[model samples]
Target chain A: GAGVSQSPSNKVTEKGKDVELRCDPISGHTALYWYRQSLGQGLEFLIYFQGNSAPDKSGLPSDRFSAERTGGSVSTLTIQRTQQEDSAVYLCASSPRQYQETQYFGPGTRLLVL
Target chain B: GESVGLHLPTLSVQEGDNSIINCAYSNSASDYFIWYKQESGKGPQFIIDIRSNMDKRQGQRVTVLLNKTVKHLSLQIAATQPGDSAVYFCAETAPLNAGNMLTFGGGTRLMVKP
Candidate 1:
């Protein structure tokens, strides 16, 4: 079966620019999550979406970070006015259902803000 | 805020030998734990998971052990191989009522020598 997939494996942009990272979760998956991994750091939870429930944005570092899942499938993570500190790998994961322990991850999109 | 952390930043082991990675989480309320492996340029891949009710679980060549008393978790790989070299992370999550977000540890870089 096809696993999670992300677009733009690598992205280099200037500071203050905006970038959108896409994620396609596996078919039938109802839970989706977005995470950020800084160089040599652990994964940081960003946002989560489950079915039609309200998304969890508590982990988002700032208001510039936001994500939306349309039709309960694909998700897009948008970072407005990107900053140098936002230069990191944005990863997406999904599970079969909410509260599922195992999450399948995508290849990720590496973003570099100059 | 409570967080998960790894006991060691790096671990080196000879191929064919057993390898063990340790983690500690501060949230005692967390009931679910998972182990993930990430290569140099990829997102995390789920290896195995264990729930609070059970102390251990095994999958293929990987085994996950949980100690609720000490808030400790460990991943043991049998006959470690070069392909197993990667950054291993342990994550913990509360129950559905509390929250579904996973708190990941810093991660342990496993270096396998053939």
Candidate 2:
């Protein structure tokens, strides 16, 4: 079976620009999550979607960061007015269920805000 | 704010040797813990998980130990191989959260000497 996957493995963008990263979860996964990893730092929670429930956006760093999951499968993380501080690896993960389950991860999209 | 941290930033071990990575978390309220392995230019792949109720859990060649009293977590790999060399991260999640938005610890880079 195919694992989770993301598009545009690498992206270099100017500051103040907007970028959208896409994620395709594994088949039969009902929960998806987005995370950010800065150099020499831990992974930071961004947002997550569970089935048809309203996505949890509390982990998003700022209003400029937003994510949307369509049809309970694919998810897109959009960064508006990107800043140099937003430069990092954007990782996506998915789980078969919501609790007590393992999350499979994608290869990730590396975004560099220049 | 409470966060997870690794005691060592890097570890080097010979192939076929056992490897141990340690992590400390600040929040006692966290109920779920997970370990992930990430290679360069890749997302984190789940290794093992242990709930607050359990002290230890094992999967394949990996074992995860959790000590709630000291707020510590550790991942041990038996017969470490070159393929096991990667950054390992420990993540925590509280019970109240509806979605699986985990708080990750700074990763420990494992270098296997073949």
DockQ per candidate: 0.72, 0.79
Candidate 2 colliding pairs, count: 0
TM-score of each: 0.97, 0.94
Every candidate's lDDT: 0.92, 0.91
Error of 2 at B30 (Å): 2.0
Per-residue lDDT of B1-114 in model 2, one digit per residue for the tens?
878999999999999999999999998889999999998877888899999899999999999999999999999999999999899999998766658678889899999999
Docking class of 2: medium
Give candidate 2's error at residue A103 in angstroms: 1.6
- Native contact recovery (fnat) for each candidate is 0.73, 0.84
Output the worst ten-in-a-row residue range by lDDT, candidate 1 chain A: A95-104
Over the stretch A1-114, how does candidate 1's per-residue lDDT look in tens digits?
Answer: 599999999999999999999999999999999999999999998999998778988889999999999999999999999999999999999998878458889999999999
Best by TM-score: 1
lDDT of 2 by residue, A1-114 (tens): 589999889999999999999999998999999989998678888899999889989889999999999999999999999999999999999999987677888998999999
Q: Candidate 2: where are CA atoms >4 Å away?
A: none
